[model samples]
Every structure is written in structure tokens, then in C-alpha cells.
Target chain A: MSEIRRRDPRREWIARNRLHRDHVSVLAVLGQGNTPSEWLGPNGVMRRNPHAVGFIGPNGLKRIDRSGGQQGGPATVATGTAASDSRQAVTIEAPAFLVAVVPDMSGGRLSSHDRDLLGLARQLADADPARPGAVLAVLFGSHKEEALGEAGVDRLLHLGDDAYEGYAPEARLAVLAAVERDLAPRHWLLPDSPLGGADLGRRLAARLGERPATGVWQLEADAEARGKNGSGWRCTARGAANTRDFLRPLPRVALALAECAEPVSETRHAAEPVTLAQPLPVLLSRIADLGPVAVDPAGVALAEAGFILSAGNGVTDWEGFHHAAKLLGATQGASRVAVDDGHMPRHRQVGATGTWVTARVYVAVGISGAIQHLQGIQSCDKVVAINRDPGCDMIKRADLAVIGDAALVLQALVTLVEQEREEKRHAA
Target chain B: MRPDPQKSPSLAITVLVSVGCHPLTGRGRRADQDARGVELARALPLAEVRLLHAGVLDAGSDAALRGYLGMGFDALTLIEQPESSDVVPALAEVLADHPPTLVIAGTRAERGEASGLLPYLLAERLGWPLVAAVAEVEGVEGGVATLLQALPRGQRRRLQVRLPAILTVDSAAPAPRQSAFGPARRGQLAVHEVGEAVPDAELVEWVEQPARKRPKRLKIVKAASARDRFKAAAAKAEGGSGQVLDGVTPEQGAEAILKLLKEEGVLRR
Candidate 1:
């Protein structure tokens, strides 16, 4: 991966042979970003937030709800201070802008969860007012103004129109029409939601003549990082593959930078908002012109992801897996057997017929380290395994080994990460 | 293309039901247990869409016959089959006869074969696009019906295909809603006698095993008391502490122990 140099950043122009440089804007399909309250305590039990309405604490740790209504329950009742004066703002100066494909951010009867998500976006927007990005929230269905007004959208693109309801494919085509017209960004950002990213990514990639990678957390163009030689940022991602490719999960983070003199990360710009309403007429006229689509980007390249936490059968039990995953800010998954048992989705399954993942920090929890499973994840920069039996194959494969139950080790890890993060938050 | 402003096609989606066979208890099909079949029928923008409550059958064929009637299908056709080498052929027969626009089947039937092969085979035989793990069927348009395929990691994909397609639904599909017991009981089931009877294959041997359990093996035993947990940790510590070498070595060991304590959260700097 080429490094982004600040001194001589990539120029904004139509560089020769640069397919990516021509791209101009981005759209981020926003969803609820939540901080889970209860966790699996060290004792291998599900912990509830005591402040969470009626539930008991997760072991002994007192649940601190940011909203403060419940001590131990999952519901985050706001004390209201977090959003008391929040407003949407952006800080990037790129020719591009930020546009969020949001659900109904209008109307009066907003759900608490949507309210929190809006608050988060508002906070981020306010923190950086210099950026030109405007929030474009897509409402799910028909609703009156009273249903959306409070969610805090900079510019609302009401999708409740008859054509936009139903499947996102139609909505996407309309969105693309709008995108091509006003805010046609070179790249598009979508949440890795089960309901949205899977099909839309493939369809969009096909539409744009680009390959999309499903479940990508980060994306960038290579041109932003590499100099003139950069064509586009390589995308690193993991998804369900043939049984043969299931053992190893590809990197979950991807960067699709453009080819340019400067690195893409240096030019890393948040999504900006552009006018989508104007293109409706033209798109309506020419939609039939679109053809069959292509698949999302294949998980063939890992351009520049330094750290990753890959899980397999090793991370057993939903509770324990979630605990370890939260500690690392990592995506969670399972082995084929676990997926078969219905604990995790077959997509998150990692094994011979599952997703292939390789990262710098590869931690194997309870996975027995089968040859097929190992084959998929062996590309990781490092390997750490925790199992009750030291004689397991995973221990032999690991650069580090701890002989203990995966659940116990994960609990310890969660505590350590939380302690460190808490200290840092206080310090900040 | 603007959907015909005048008339939208009336599409009726039919879901076939089959029960898993018990060696002794026989076969029982739960057609009413199906909500997705109903949901898919509802998703169509047709004038009339109905759910077929196919009756319990000894084989996949038995269910298909009842499904044909319960769904208020335009016609009834029997799907003939030989000794059950597999139910794929029976399905093929029905699909060939009816040539229905949309055929939906459960990914797996709780049956003697219980193999989730019918949907895939049907797709291959019928040469229609098959979508598994479907959460929703958005709508059918211009000879193509749009479907919402649910992928792993909570991702959903939307697909559009012409009619005469087959979709096999997995458990991940939307949960079926409760049917009114009254209407379900009174629903008419017309059974068509299968004519193209294929000889049934003889079963050699059937091997059965217990269902697989989730792989969460790490068990953490909560201690009765915090002091007990501390004692257990102390007891579990393999190395004996405090070896005073009375010089440089002693200081190095002490520093190492303190570092370990700090790292483990037993001590905080």
C-alpha cells in the first residue's frame, strides 16, 4: 500500500488512465451505532445493566447508561444532556461532501434508538463544521413531517415516495440517478447491515463497473495514497465463499483509493451531501438503459489493514464472542459447525466452506485449529490461541498460547480493554 | 418502464409443505407453520394471492398435491415419482406441468430424506434463478420478480428475475405469522392423482445421529464470593512468589512480578 504524503498530496484533476480520479462524491448509508451496555462477565454469565430498567448488573459492575434511565437494561434512556444542543456539521474541505442515507429523521414519533443514532451523527457533524458534507437521510416509508422533524437531518431526501418504497434495488437505482446528477461521488459508503449491504453492494458495483466487497468497515481509493502510479485503493474484505475458501477470513477492512500522486488516506474525505432531487426526471427516462449487474469486489486483496481480530469456532457462545469482539472493535464470526448450530450466521462462519480472514492480530478462541480452518486464517501477521487443552493444534499454530478456557480468557481481555479505554477517556 | 398503468398482473404464490418423517411416528407436514409462504404471497401486487396449506404426506409428493389446492392455484397437476431416490423428480414433474411463474419451497423438509436438495435441484431442472436465505420478495416486474436475499452478517440483497423462477427459503427468511385456525381448517385441498409414476428406489441403509449442539465450550464458573475467586486465582498461580536472591537477581524478579501484576490488573500504576 502506498503511504499518503501530506507535503505533496494528490492533485484534483483528470489524470490520464485514472478511472478512480474521475469519481467525485460519496453517499454513506447510516445506521444506529450503539455501545452495548451488558457484557459477559468473567464468570461466563450474561451481565445485565442494573440501571437497565429492571435487569440486574452484569456480575458486579454497575451499568452506567449514558441515557441513565435504566441501570442494567439494554434500553438507553437519555438523560437528554447528550443531545441538549447537538447539531449536524462537517469538517472536510474536499470538493466532495457528506450525505447520509438515513431513515426517517423527520416526524415527531422517533424511536429512542434512531434518536441516539441521529445524536451521534449530529455530534460528529458539529465537531467538524469545516467539511462540506450534508446529511442526506432516506426515510423507509411514507410518513408525515411530525414523524421526522426531530431526528436532525441537514437535508432530507424523503424516500417514502411510491417508487422508493419496497426493495432498496429500486431505491438504489433512483439514488444512483440522483447521485449521477448532483452528488455523484467517486465512492459510496454503506453500513454492513444484513438488510442493505449484501445485495446493494453487488448491484452498485455492477452499476459502477466496480467490484464491491461486502461487510467492509473502511474504504478508500489507492490514488489517494500512492502517487501517480496509484490506480485505486485495494479493498480488503471477508464474505461467505465456497467451502474450500471458508477456513480463512479475508481482512474485514478495505481501502479503495484512487491513483494519484498523493496517498488516498491523506485525501481521506468524509461523505458530503449533494442535490439528489433534481435527477429524478432524467433517471426516470433512462432507467431501462441499465443492464445486468456484477458481483461485489472479490476478497482477493488486502491493501493496507494493519490490525484485525479473526474469530472461528474458538470464540464460542454468542455472549463470550461478543465480549471478545467488543474489546478489539473487531467483527465476530464462527466456525462452520457453530454456524450450522445456528448461533452465528452462515456468512460469519469461518471454516473450509466459510469466509477467509487474515489480519495482523489473529486471535483464535476455541477453534480447534483444523487444517481447513487454519488454511483460511494462516495469512494473519500474528496468531494467538486460547483453549483448555494445550495440545490442540491451534496452540501449535499460535505465536502465543494461553492454556485456559476461551470464555475465561476473553472475559479477562474484556476487563483489560475496558480499563484501558476508561483510563483514556478520563485522560481525554 | 412504467408498470402498466391499467392492469397489474394477479400473481398467486404457492408454497409446498412437507413433514420430516419419523421412523415410527410416520410423517407430519406443518403447512400452517409457514409464515414466509404467506408473506411471499402477500408481497405480490396481484389481485389475488393465497397461501396453500398442504396436508401431511408420507412423501414429498403428498404435500405437493395439497399445496396445489390450498393455494387456490389455477390448476391441479400430480407429480409422479418412482421409489424415493429423491423428491427432485416429483417436483420437476409438477413444475413442468403447471409451469407456474413462481414456485417456493422450504429449504429442507423434516422427512426421511430431510436433505435440503429439492430447492437446488428444482432450480437446476427448471433453469430458473434460485435465491436462498430470502427475507423478502419485493415485487415482480416486467416478467421479472424482485427478491430480497438475506446473506450472512445481517446483509440483504435484492434481486429481480423474470417469472417462472424458483426460490427456496431458509429458516432465516421472515418468520411466518399465525394463521386463523378457522380459515385454515375450512380451506379446500384438491389432490390430483400423479400419472407419470417413476419407480421408487429402494433404500439401502439409513444412518441417524443426534442433532449438533452450538460450539460454545468455554465455561466460566462464577465463584460464590469475591474472596473465593481471589483465593482461586492465587491457588491457580503456578509459580511460588518472593524468592529473595538478595542482589541484582532479586530486584529483577521483583520488577518482573510487579509488571505482571500491573499487566493483569491485579495492580494499577
Candidate 2:
């Protein structure tokens, strides 16, 4: 069976002949692989035997292309797509009560953190299907977010008035007060983020005299603490600079972390417009918004940097590193050695002993990552290393490692980035 | 009460400090934000800064409180409050008694519940304007404080909060200066006997355990058919061993890095 057998000429000719009526059946009679596969059934159907077609791969896994490419009938490529999404449009016309959510809406868009907060709102709202509670999203100021309904908001109370804009926590809190009086929401959920939710949420909780549960990461039904009405929910929240966890009863107001619960991906809600029954009261505010200050990204704190350009002892060309960081518009971070050498400020140090950074993209230029440095950047989504030594721990941890002189690599990168920017500008 | 606005009056700044717990090792330390608040207070020109704390002084808390005093303070006022009691009332009362020109504090403590509701609650109780997430207090002029408030992604908003305003220092604020050993050792902890302990009603009811690691979310492919699911399941886990570009020219390495930056959507046009 291992040897390549000479084909029978008569059968081959018959199978090749288009005019032959038995040609189709004869084709099937010609088995596929090293082993005989299948035969033509009496009803003119080809019975497939898959084991005969495929060979075991190097890792001892069976490899087979079920696209019918072996004996092509236009290859039954099953690139099947779902006709429609899994999302179901839901409307809670007469909700028993309301659960309010106030999103940060930074840059006039609902951030991922906002979406997660809304997800938590949905959980509390849809906890009991028998008497579903609607999620009322109080969106102050102007927001460009289009899919409020898709984000699991049942009622959208948008106050696009100029008064609700920037640094107007007083006016925003007034609107929230109106919400508390009118809707009397059962629960208020906000993101435990610094953008706006943390500030506004804390104010809302304080103004309402409700003790809030901040940094809540998870919620669970406590059977032992179940009330007469229904199952009472408890939560685990980060405490004391995130050193400890506090298990506390789910408060009327809950400031949750990102991914506390998954974002609403399975359902779309009716984003019905809501208005306060009574006109909003004008509260005299002592605080005034002077607009935003123009700050260099490099001067920003390492903990909040979305992208970081970090330097270490191996970075001999300090001037070039700074230039590259500026060109890249990244926050500056440094290793302990760099800081100790007076190259970078103490505040710019990145490590367990320094500031724990959660940068999305951390580029370590010439850094031999110490354990503390790695610990500080553990929350970073991706790390890119440009190092002279390939065996450095930073290189091992990096998703992409460029083993070369850090100075040269950074210089070349800056040039490429500039070129790309030029092309983009021209195209635009 | 605010000072008479006739002349260039000196400001009396009160900083509310708290015991902080280290994240890695659960030892007591000066809370980061609170330390920053102290630093912010100290930076204000012509302002006499006073540190206030509301917690029991003990072996564990002693180290934490001393951590605050080590920031070049001769002494810090301490109110003897219990471990699990609400400190808002005691702190609010103290503020009302003294009535400083401005109240500066961290948004939250680094110990206990750390709900970040202290300044807000104090402001509500005192009926004063509260500014949260403050990075820096620029200046005080004509009873108005010009401040820099921290926003997400390192953005800053300038605010003019009327004096007697409560400012909560943001984590993004300038990092606190090192606490010197001399100041820490010499600084005295003045113990003040305060009102009865009011237990945190809600916190006392719930159970607490050492935090279990939050499960990392897996990439869920919403496949329609079994074949797609099979394909997704059989796919190798990505980034197991990173792509190392060794022996490549700097240009090639840069090009690769640029590509990755583009793919990550981090490179701005």
C-alpha cells in the first residue's frame, strides 16, 4: 500500500471520459489517499471516510481540511456567518424601579470604564426578571456617544445645557439631586475611575447621604443575608490603597472597577428619553471651570500614562531618548538606576518601590528590568523592548524585542514615525 | 471662617492625613495621596500648614502616622478613633471648631474601607465647596483658590474654587518628598481624645477575606457553528515566546517597532 501503484489504463480512461454515464461513479471508486477512503453508494452518493484522508501532524494532532478540496465540488467552504447578532432588543415599559448610572463620558465618548459601569447597572437592574428595574443613565454636558441604548441604558437623561459642561459638579449634582427626588432610583452605579465618575459619584453618594462602596470588583448573592424581599447582593471592594479587600453589602451607590461585570454584549435596551418633572434649580456654585491646562505628556504621571517611554542605565544617549519620547508623545518613565543617577526625577521611577504604572503600551529603551520594575508594569497590556542585550529580563517579558543599540533603534523609530506622520498628513 | 480680605492676609491651611497600607506588603505607611496633600499644603506661600489625623495611635498605626510627620513636620494632631468607626463626624467637627482658611486632604485613605468619600462627606457636613482630584493648588487670591484638577489620561482642568473650599489631592499630583529620618524621629504625635466610635454600619455586616485574584477574561469568539468553535479552540495561544529581532539592522528593527505601534493604535498621526 506504501508503493505508488501503476493506474489501470482502462478504468482511468473511463473515469476521464465526460460522455461515460458511469464516469461520476468511477471517480469516486478512485480512493483518495494512501488508504482506500470511500465508495460510491447505490443511491449515487459519495460516502466519505475522513480517517483515510488526513495524516497526524508533528504535535500528534490530526490535520484535515474539511473544505472538500481533496475532490473539489467547488470546495464546500463553510465560512458560515451568523445571519444576525445574538443581541436581543429589550424594553421594560413599566419598571418596578430604577437603577441610575452616571457615566464619565470623557472626550464626549463613553469609555470602556463607563461601559463596565453600565454593565454593573444592568446586573442590578435585571437581577429579578419578575420585576425588572430599568437602568437610567444620567448623562450631563454634551456627549457624542451614539449607542446609549446598545450600552444597556434603558432611560437616558441627557442635560446638554452649557451649565452642565466642564467643572460644573455643582450643576451636575443638582441634576442628580433632581433624579434622586423624581425617579428615586434604587441603586446608583458609577465607574471607580478618576476621569469624572469617581468625583461625581462620590458627590452623588455624599449629597444623597448614602455610604458608597468604592472600588467594587465583584458582586455575589449572599444566601445567608437574603432579605424578605429577595436575595441580597454583597460585593468585594479594594481597600486601603488596594492593599486589602472589603466584603460589604451592596450599597445604594456602588463605584465599580472596570470589568466588575462584563459589558452588555447580549442585549440592547430602549434608551427612552427622560426629563425631570420639576424644572432644575439653579444652585449658586463657588467653583468655576477655567477650562483645561495644556500639559506636556512627558510631564504626566507614570501611573496614568497610556503610553510610556522608559529609560534605564543602558540608555547612554539621554538627549536622543528625550527627543524620541517627545516625538512619540509618551509619558516618561525610568528605572531605579536612572533615577539614582540623576538622569530622571524620583517621581519618574517605575517599579514596585516607585509608581505602579498601568500603561497600555510601555516601551522600555535600554532597561534591564529589575523584578520591582516588572512588578510595577505588570498591569501594562503590552511591553516593547529596545535593548543592547538580548538576554535581559525586559527582552524576555517584551512582546516585541529589538536587540540592538537602544540609541540607534530609537533614532530610526523616530524617523519612521515622522515619515508615517508626513504621509498621513498629506493623505488627509 | 475666612480671613478678612482687606490686605494680603496669610492663609491657614489644614491638611487631613491618614495611615496608608503598602500594597505589596500590608505594612503601615503614609498614604500616598495624603502625603501629596501635605506637600501641596507646604508649597502654598505664606500659608501655615497643620496636619490632622483621626485614628488610634498604636504600634502599627504609629509607623504610618510617623510616615506623615517625617515630611518635615514637628508634630501632627491625632484624634483617638477606633479601627472600624466613621471618621467623618470627628474630622468634620474638628474642622468646624478650627475653621481654617482652606481644608486639604486626600480623596481616600490607604487603610480601612478606603471609599474615597471623606472630603465629600466633610464638605457636605460643613456646607463648603469641595473640589475632588486636585493636582495642585496654584494660588489663593481674593478668597478664590486657583487649582489644577486631574482628569483621566493625564489631562488637567484649572478651577477657581472659593476659599474655605475642601481640596482632595489626586494620585496624579506631584509625588510627595521623601520623609526624613530626623523629622520622623523628632516629630511628636499629639493625642487628642475625641467622641464615641460610630461603627461603619454596613461594613460591619459584611464578610471580608484576602482578595482572590480576579479571573482574567478570555477572548470569547462568538462563533455560529461547531467548526468555527473547533478552529478557535485549536488555535495556538499567542505570545508564548515573543518575536526577538536579533542581528537585524536598526532600520529594520525600527520598522518592525513602528509596525507594532501602528497595530497597537498607539502611534498618533
Best by TM-score: 2
lDDT accuracy of residue B68 in candidate 2: 82
Cα TM-score per model: 0.32, 0.69
lDDT of 2 by residue, B52-142 (tens): 9997779988988888878888889999887778888899888899899899898887767778888888998999999988999888998
Worst 10 residues of 2 chain A by lDDT: A72-81
Task: For residue A406, give model 1's deviation from the true position in Å.
Answer: 23
Give the interface RMSD of each candidate.
20.0, 7.3
Candidate 1 per-residue lDDT, tens place, A158-188, comes to 5455565444354555575456456554334
Cα deviation of A47, candidate 1, in Å: 65
